[model samples]
Target: MSRTPPARFTRPRIALLAAGALVAGAAGTAAAANPDTRENAAAAPGCTVDYKVQNQWDTGFTTAVTVTNTGDPAGSWQVEWSFAGNQKITQGWNTQISQSGTAVTAKNVSYNGSLGTGASASFGFNASYSGTNAIPTVFKLNGVTCTTGPGGPGGPTDPPDPTDPPAGARVDNPYQGAKVYVNPEWAAKARSEPGGSRIAGQPTGVWLDRIAAINGVNGGMGLRAHLDEALRQKSDGELVVQLVVYNLPGRDCAALASNGELGPTEIDRYKTAYIDPIAEILADEKYSGLRIVTTVEIDSLPNLVTNTGGRPTATPQCDTMKANGNYVKGVGYALNKLGDVPNVYNYVDAGHHGWIGWDDNFGPSADLFKQAATAEGATVNDVHGFITNTANYSALKEDHFKVTDTVAGKSVRESKWVDWNRYVDELSFAQAFRDKLVSVGFDSGIGMLIDTSRNGWGGTARPTQPGPTTNVDTYVNGGRYDRRIHVGNWCNQSGAGLGERPQTAPASGIDAYVWVKPPGESDGASKEIPNDEGKGFDRMCDPTYEGNPRNGFNMSGALPNAPLSGHWFSAQFQELMKNAYPPLP
Candidate 1:
């Protein structure tokens, strides 16, 4: 059989920085809270503005409130309110507000104090509460009850002993049109400093990921993970991140595989690793505006194609990848439960539908979509929809389905590889996938993303003695897609020709595009012609591939197979981030 290279994948460039990032347009985001709403809540009896939060399961409330006002008259304006005896304000915003079961106290905040009736300010905080919790009854201002009027639309009203706030106090989700990302420790490190600079964190900006490690609640990509940083870093828009949870206990790559471990069990791990992180991060006040969405195979498909667990039984055979029910259980769990996360969302893998052929019906993919949502009892937010641009005015592709003998001869044996010149055609394939995804039942407006991680073909990128020979700057095989589409691990025996990171979604008319995989990482295990050994970073460059001293994870600097060499890989990351988002301001 012709060993045609596999297609590549990508995600928004992960934030890799040497110094901390201010995030893109972070300054504009600090004004996240609406001054008007804060003022609305401030008008109460006794400037002792007390607040309570609800709508939670056991141990799941992280809401708090603060009161502030414009520079008006009135020296001492106290704000106070009475709770129904259920929820408590764990933390205060601009004041030292305290909650003791039902009774609460809202004192003047030292720095942010003084309502003056109109200075244009508000207070917020986080808390942990749950079950049948309601808003306070009476709100007093200046020690004397102001007798708050009927709470208007999007406002809460005070009723006699009213346990709950008025029915119209709920706020809509503000995470629409945002992207979030997740990754493992290696990817995590890459994200912190893409391209030598820290990616900024602004409200409504993206969180490029490094790896998608779905392990456990604490270790998982749950709310507790990066939420606080997202919230504290910026205060506006939505904390949009591209989440790519790649911990399928047993996964398979290179076309198709029956490896079910990477299937359901891996998915279960996703719930804990990926899903739970959102909840954990949301637990912080900063994540109030953060919206998280998973990036499909966001990072290197090492788990899919390269087996860290063991050698593959064979390609296209899913026996190794069939560890779990397609990791469907985990994915289902996340889909059903994502709605509960403060600013969380999802996108099920809608593999480049073009791979299935242009005429394929989006509706027929229903089984996959349905399993993602209802099966796991999750609030399936969206789907990957279309991955390839198989057919389009541009006709794009991420794989080198058409390779030249010259490029192949530089590597291992003779195999039909992807065509670089024709790869961009994959984008056309992606568009078709998009239409099919929409037909299946994705949110009409929920945006989708494309990964430009790699181009699939092994890189003989730069002529080196022991690596895949040739070219100085050809995109790691024209993009990570090359090494991935139909290849094995460690295609980086030398370099992936590392494409300059993309700026946003393919300027080629994509909803959103990002670097799902951390640049400079290993593809697991592979055999390049010239290198004639493992070319992946984790394995090939481990000094173990050619029985050389490439060192283990500690290997640093530019060497063979080490796609993640500290300085060298960091430079690649720098480029990817540059392409993902503009430099942090």
Candidate 2:
């Protein structure tokens, strides 16, 4: 039984009420506050600090702080401040943060250490406070007091140099103001098909799914080749190159369609042979200008939550992977090594809502992610964000209905389709899961990416309005856009279509709408075929096979005559373009 579904898949405020000039204190200290939550303080004579309380609740708050270097360029930087109240930071991202009583120190991690003159680096933290959450009155950048008064050193007149790239510093969102790399290889394949030219130029993830992929697999583009092509595509400005960092030991434990080459205990080989080489290539200075976004280890960790132990969907392979601890260790090792590359942004693969949206799987999945992040010397900071629905066909949104909707006086979740899941679609699940992650110690600033590659269930069958209020099943079945017999039917889904075109900041907490799973690529073979890539023939990929507990015991719903996973499937491609939502022009 294959458990695979689709494809892989602060507040604060503290203000002194006035916008007043900074009051200089002894030893070159200066402090100023605005009517809003933002406060500026001078750190030494070379840096300025802007601290803003982003959100606040009864006992906790989140803050974003930016430090700008005003003096000579430095290879590294640090920002220090002291809280007036008994505030303790619970977790932080993008920097190493430590609190000594009320005093706090935030130091740049490996990737963001370089601070060019007039360059700024930002980091944020979530903290707990009792009573007042007063804004810090002073800030020190690299031990220098930051001054922001009129005509003062490091003041408003001398702003950060807009043209200067902060060496290896990361942007808030890598996709914003950037052109994503279009894989000429995948594009060529797409152009070969009739009308494929329409989406041939669109960006899709370069999947480094196996060790052979590190170098060219069967003379295909290697890691360096892709980066070089990205550089060519990027004439100037920023360019985001998406890489799918898969190939974990015991990979895709719950499914045979995408099984990996490595044995269950090959943690050392995964780190040394797989992640290490990729990290080395990414760290190379030649590729530093390109913003490399890596979707790390798809379909690995989530199995530990939903398909392990005594769960109805549990597999012996999943149980073995969970017991061996290679999944957590491998993910941690990957996050740690890949994160060291300054321009590389690591987004862990969070399974889509259909697989883990239930009450039992959601929280445990987040908790397991934290465990992986903290294991093998990896920290939450290594994860820049998370990507959901990497290769599966989960609808980006359900416009006609929601999980909260009550059809015939019963919640829509009770429907066989929803099956008591907390979320009805990918967007809601991603947002809510992000919140859950933060509450469990991820950085508050973390963003999410949704793979809209094949989720759009458009076509003649797409529902334009809500279903009749006859019953919950009819309401959900009639109005739903996803045509899958069950959400768990993930292998080369018959009605799946190209979702939203890749775009930046599509929604709150979403970094971008990505196509990580390139369209036309088969999820797995419809029948068992011999291959050296370690992929296997799973029954879920067979159109005639009955389903398992993971998919509610329905028909597999997979398309027939599919090739092996990752191979191009022309029939599936044409169908996707035909049914594309927002209909392809």
Local lDDT at 410 for model 1? 41
lDDT per residue as tens, model 2, 44-156: 24666767554454566556566767766789888888989999998676689999998899999887788876676767666778898888867887787764466443356
Q: Roughly what TM-score does model 1 have, to 2 decimal places?
A: 0.43
The residue-level lDDT of candidate 1 at 477 comes to: 42
Q: How close is candidate 2 to the true structure, as a TM-score?
A: 0.73
Give lDDT per model, in order: 0.36, 0.81
The count of backbone overlaps in candidate 1 is 189
Model 2 global lDDT (CA atoms, 0 to 1): 0.81
Off by over 4 Å in 1: 1-225, 253-286, 296-317, 320-326, 350-370, 379-424, 453-490, 493-509, 525-559, 563-585
